[model samples]
Structure formats: C-alpha cells, structure tokens
Target chain A: MNVQDIQRILRADLLCGEEHLGREVQTACGSDMMSDVLAYVKEQSVLLTGLVNPQVIRTAEMMDMVCIVFVRGKRPNEDMIELAKERSIVVMSTKFRMFTACGLLYEGGLKGGCKV
Target chain B: MHYVVPPDDFTRAGEASSAVKKTLKQIGMNPDVIRRVAIAMYEGEINMVIHAHGGEITVDVAPDRVDMVLADEGPGIADIERAMQAGYSTAPEEVRNLGFGAGMGLPNMKKYTDEMTVESTLGVGTTVRMSVFNHAG
Candidate 1:
C-alpha cells in the first residue's frame, strides 16, 4: 500500500514529507528499541514506533526506510522532523498504539519484511 | 571521509554514516551496497557514542568496497565473545531508555558487512574495522 493508505488506515497526521504520500510501502516493523530495529529490520519501508528521538530518524535513514509512524500520538521534536525532512522521509503521528498500528497495516497486506 | 564523534552526543551519532550514505548515493553506488555500508557504519557510530566517550570514524570508499574503521578510547569490552551475543548489552540504564544499548550493535555491524574485525585493550580502547563489497558474488 501507499503512504496515503497507511495514513487513512491509521488516522494519522502527516508531520512531514506530504509529497511522498503516493509512495508505496510493502512492509513495516514496530519497536521502541532502536537497536532491535537496526538489527532485525530488512527492507521494511515503514517503521511504527513509539519512541521519539532524533536517533529514530537516524535509524530509519540507516535502514533506508521511507517513512515512520509515531504510534500513540507521540509527536517528534523539531530536530527529528527537520532530520526526516532532510532525508525526504515521511513522518506521521497516529493515535493508534503500537500493536494496533502494526496489526492494521498487516491486515491491510503489509508484511513484516523478514522471515523468522 | 573522516568524522569525529562528540562524546555522549546521542543525537549526533549517525552524522558520519549519513554523510557516507550521501557520498555513496552521489557516486551512484548500488542501493544494496549503500544500505549495507550505511547500516554497518551507523551501528559502529552509535556504538562509539554509547559505549566509548566518543571516537573517530574513517570511511574509505572504493570501486569495489566501502571500508570503515571506528576507533575509540573507552572502557574496552571485557569479553568480546559475550559482547557479540545479541541482547547482552553493557549500556547503562539511561542509554537503554534512549532506545539503544540492546547489545545488538556489534552483531549488526558484523551482519551487514562482508568482513569485520574488532580489537580492544581493557581499560584502554577499541577499534572496529568493517567492509562491504560493492558487487554481490
């Protein structure tokens, strides 16, 4: 599905990268631990995380992720948004908790992107 | 490219890796190769910030490979074997609260690189060298 679909499905607000709403994403991972995300994420284009920090954006960038969904309405600070803007990564905030957000996206056919 | 990681600056830890990613992108490296290099180096960079006081990262980008050397003067790893184990972190509680220090850093660094080596002296310093080959054989 595309970024727009995720936005609508999760009732998310676009914090940055509005123009990227049309981009497609096939997989996602949800985790608060940046280390786990870095270690296990494989080709996941969307990250659903509750953690709000600049390193979250950095993690997304390092993994080549196209977007991040801040679950539980946890808004990122200006630095995080600016960093995501610089990388052209879409940032969004959702009221859904981490588990719900991941489930909704998975129900919408977005796989986990890793076989384990 | 060379970068100095400021001590305990969690926010700036990935700068070197980000710069390297941009350079590789500009030079039109393969996306897979670029991703591997970026992730590996970023892990190393984060390790420097979290474990070491700070460190120096030198990246040598070649036609066939991207090599990264991260050197830091920190409380060296007491047990290299255990440190390499997933989920065995030595990072303090504050560092864990920052969403890192899960003990996946070194393993992730090794996972993404074609070759990797670690050298450390107790109470002195540690150095990690990693390389990712440009072409998949």
Candidate 2:
C-alpha cells in the first residue's frame, strides 16, 4: 500500500510531504526505540513511532524510510517537520495508540517487514 | 570526511551520517554498503551525544571500504563487554525516555558493520572504530 492508504487506515493527518502521498510502503516497523529500528529494519519504507523528536526523523532517514506515522496523537515539532521535509519523508500524526495503529495497518495488509 | 558532533544537541545528532549517506549515494556506492555505514555511524554519533560530551567522527571512503572513527572526551565505558550486550544501558532515565539508551547502540553498530572495536579509558574518554566493506552484489 501507499502512504495514502496508511493514512486512511489509521486516520492519520498529513503534516508534511503531501506531494509524496502516493509513495509505496510495502513493509513497516513500529518502535519507540530508534536503535532497535536501525538494528532490525531492512528495506522498509514506513516507520510508525511514538517518540517525537528530531532523532525519529533522522532514524527514518538513516534507514531510507519514506514515511513516519506518529502514534498516540503525538505531533512533531517544527524542527522535525522541517527535517522530514528536507529528507523527503512523509510525516503524519495519528490519534490511535501504538498497538491499535499497528494493528490497523497490519489488518490493512501491512506486514511487520522483518525477516527475523 | 571529518564531522564534529555538537555536545548534547539531540536535534543535530545525525547530521554527519546524513551528509555521508548523501555523498555515498551521489557517488553510486552500493545501497547495502551505504546503509550499513549510515546506520553504524549514526548509532555511534548518537552514543557520542548521549554518553560522551560530543565527539569527532572521521570517515575514510574508498572504492571497496568505508572506515569511520568516533572519538569522544567523556566518562569512558567501565566495561566494554557489558556495554556491548543488548539492553544493558548506562544512560540516564531521561535519555531512555527520549527513545534511546536501550543499550543497543554499540551492539547495533557491530551488527551493521563489517568490523568494530572500542577503546576507552575510564574517567577519560572513548573511541569507536568501525568499517563496512562492499560485498559483491
């Protein structure tokens, strides 16, 4: 699915990178820990995270992820949004909690995307 | 390339890695190799910001290998083995609350790179060296 599909599935609001909404996201990983995400993720395109900080966007960029879904109604600061825009990563804010948001995405055909 | 990581600036932690990644991409480096370097360097960078009082990361890029050295002047690691273990962290509660300090930083660095070594002096400082080599795609 694409970022738009994920937005629809989880009721997310697009905060930036609107032009790239059609970007394809075959797999995703959810984590509040950036280190775990960096260690385990491979070829994933979307990141669902609860921690709101510049490092979140930086983690996604390091992993080459194209989108970030902020769970638990957490919103990124202006610096994060600016960084995401610079990195061409789509940023969204969702009201669902981490588990619920992940479940919805999984039910909507998004796999965990980890081979392990 | 040499990068000086700012002290305690969580917001600017990954700028060096990002710059290197962009350069590697522009030069047509292997995607796997580029990502490995990026992740390893990023983890080291974060460690410097969180544990060390900022540091310098120097990267040497060659046709077949990417080498990086992260040096920091902060309270050095008391136990290298313990620090390498997953989920073993010395970071404060606040750092953990920021979604880091999971004790996976060094381990993850080792996991992604081809070679890694840590040299630290207690109460003095620490330095990390890691390399990533391109395997035939």
Candidate 3:
C-alpha cells in the first residue's frame, strides 16, 4: 500500500515528507525498541513505534525505512522531526494504539517481513 | 576519512556512520555493502554512546574490504556469550526511551558484517572490530 493509504487507514497526520505520501511500502514492523527494529526488521518499509527520540530517526536512516508512524498520538520533538525531514523519511502520528494500528494496516494488506 | 567519537554528547551518536556512508558513496561501493557497513557501524556507534561514554572509530578502506574498529573505555562487556544472545540487554530505561536497549546491538553488528570480534577488559575498556568484504556478484 501507499503512504497515503496508511495515513487514511490510520487517520494519521503527516508530520513530514508530505510529498512522499504516494510511496509504496511492502511491509511493516511495530515496536518501540530500536534494537529489535534494527535486528529483526528486514524489507519492512514502515516502522510503527511509540518511542520518540533522535535515535528513532537514526534507526530509520540506517534501515533505509521510508516511513515511521508514531502510535498512540505520540509526537516527536523538533530534533527528531528535523532529522526525519533531513533523511526524507515520512513521519506520521496516529491516535490508534499500537495493536490497533498494526491490525488495521495488516487488514489493509501490509504484511510484516521475515522475523529474525 | 577518520573521526573521533565524543562520548559526552548523545546528539553526535551517528557521526561515524554518516561519514562511512558518505565515504562508501564516494568510493563507489555497492549499495548492499554500503548498507551493511552503515548498519553495522551505526550499531557500534550506538553501543559506544549508551554503554561507553564515547569511543574511537577507525575505518580502513580497501578495494574489496572495509574494516571498522570501535574502541571504548567504558564498562566492559561481562559476557560475550550471553551478549551475543538475540534478546539480552542491560541498557537503562532512558536509553530505551531513545529507541535502543532491546539487546540486539551486538547481534546486529554480527549480522551486517562478514567478520566480527569483541575484546573487553572489565573497567578498562572494550574494542569491537568488524569488517565487510565487497562482493562483486
């Protein structure tokens, strides 16, 4: 699905990378742990997490992830947003909790990649 | 290009990774090798900040191989065996808040590199050496 689909499905606010809303993402991973996101995540383009910090942006940068949706209405501070903006990674915030967000996206045909 | 890791600052965590990525791009390395080196070195950078106060990173570039050495004087790893486990972490809550602390740092380092080694001395320091060989397939 596209970033727009994810935004519409999750009712998320695009905090950055508005022009990238149409990018295609094949898989998704939900976690607040950066280490888990780094280790187990493979071919997953979207990261759903409640964690907010500079490292989140760094993790996405390292993973080559295209989008990050902050679950639970959590908004990242200026530094994080700036970092994401610099990397051109779409940043979104949704009111849906983690489970609901993952389920909704899963129902929308976004699958999770290999779990290592 | 070589750079010093300043442990007192959290904002500078990925400086080494960034530099390496830039160098890989400049040197025309394959994307896969670049990504591997970036991810592995980035993991090591985070480990340096969260565990050691700061550390030093040396990158030796070659036509077919990239060698990285990250040395830190922070508290040494007590157990290499357990630390290599996929789900063991001793990171504090604050570090966790920053999106790390899930215990996959070392493992990810291994996963993204061709060869990796860890040498540590309690209270003295720890050094992690990793290398990724370019595959021209």
Candidate 4:
C-alpha cells in the first residue's frame, strides 16, 4: 500500500514529506521500543511508533525505512521533522492508539515485515 | 571525515552516520555496504550520546572495508555479556523517554557490521570497534 492508503486507513495526518504520499510500503512494524524495531525489522519498511525523539528519525534512517507513523496523536518536534526531511523519510501522526493503528494498516494489506 | 561528538546536544545525533554515508557514497562503496555501515555506526553514535555523554568516532576508509572506532570516557558497561544481550539495556528513564533503551543498539551494531568488538570498564569508559566489508570490491 501507499502512504496515502496508510493515511486514509489509519486516519493519519501527514506532518512532512507530503510529496511522498504515493510511496509504497509493503511491510510495517509497530513499537515504542526503538531497540525492537532495530532488532526485528527487515527489508525496506515503515515504522509505526508513538515514540518521539531525534533517535526515532535516526533509526528510520538507519533501517532505510521510508516512513514513520506516530500513533496516539503524537506529533514530532521541528528537530525530528527536519531530520526526517533530510533523510527523505515521511512522517505522519494519527490519533489512533498503537494497536488500532497497526491493525488498520494490517487490515489495509501491509504485512508484518519480519518472521524471526 | 572525522568528528568529535558534542556532549551537550541531542539534536545532532546522526551527524556521524550522515558523514559515513556521504563518504561511502563518494568512495563508490556498494549501496548495501554503505547502508550497513551507516546503520551500525549510527546506532553506536546514539549509544554514545545517550549513555556516554559523547565520544569520538574515527572512520578509516580502506580498499576493502570501512572501519569505525567509537571511544568514550563516560561510565562504562559493567557487564559486556549482559550488555550484548539483544534486549538488555542500561539506559535510564530519561534516555528511554528519548525512545531508546530497548537494548538493541549493540546487537544492531553487530548485526550490520561484519565484525564487532566491545571493550569496557565500569566507571571508566567503553570502546566499540566495528568494520563493514565492501562487497563491491
């Protein structure tokens, strides 16, 4: 699915990289723990997280992830947004809880990225 | 390019990673190898900021490998074995508030790099040395 589909499905607000709405995301993982995201994620991925920090953007950049969806209505600060923008990573925020947002995206056909 | 991680700023977390990525690109390293080095070094750099206050990162670009050494003189890991555990972490709540401390930093460092070694002493400091081989060669 594309970023547009994820936004519509999760009812998310695009915070940055609106030009990337058409970018495809085939897999995703949801976690507030950046460690688990780093440990378990595979392939080019989308990160669904409620965590807000410069490290979040750094992690996305490290994993070569294309997008990050902040759950629980959390919005990233300017520094975080700027970091994502520099890395060409899309950032979005949604009012849905983590589980709900993940479920919506899963139901929308984005699969879990790692099997291990 | 070499950098001394500033002790006071959390906003500048990924500067080392960006530099390494740019250097790798300029050197025409394989894109996959560049990604691995970037991820590994970035994680190590974040660890330095959150746990060590800051550190010095030295990147050695060789014909076959990219070598990274991250050295810090802050409080060191008490137990290297436990610290190396995939889910273990010593980062405090404040650091966690910054969205880390899930304990994958070291392991991810190991995962993305072809070789890694950690040397540490409690109350002293830690040094992480890792290298990623260029597959393009």
The per-model lDDT (C-alpha) reads 0.91, 0.92, 0.89, 0.86
**Candidate 1 structure quality by residue, lDDT tens digits, B20-116:** 9999999999999998898888888888888888999998988899888999999998999999888888899998889998889889988999999
Chain B TM-score (model 2 vs. true structure): 0.97
- How would the docking of model 4 be graded? medium
By DockQ, the best candidate is 1
Least accurate 10 contiguous residues by lDDT in model 4 chain A: A35-44
Off by over 4 Å in 4: none
Instruction: State the DockQ, from 0 to 1, for candidate 4.
Output: 0.68
lDDT of 3: 0.89
Q: Pick the winner on DockQ between candidates 2 and 3.
A: 2
Q: How would the docking of model 1 be graded?
A: high
lDDT string for model 3 (A1-116, tens) is 99999999999999999989899999999998888888864677999999877878888888889999999999998888988998889999999999999999999999998754
Backbone clash numbers for all candidates listed: 0, 0, 3, 0
Candidate 4 residues B17-134, lDDT tens each? 8878877888788878888888888888889888889999999988789899999998999989898888798888887777778788998899889999999998889999999998
- Chain A vs. true chain A, TM-score per model, equals 0.97, 0.97, 0.96, 0.95
TM-score of each: 0.97, 0.97, 0.94, 0.93
Among residues 3 or more apart in sequence or in different chains, the pairs in candidate 3 whose N, CA or C atoms overlap within 3 Å are A34-B99, B7-B53, B7-B54
**Residue A82, candidate 4: C-alpha displacement in angstroms:** 2.1
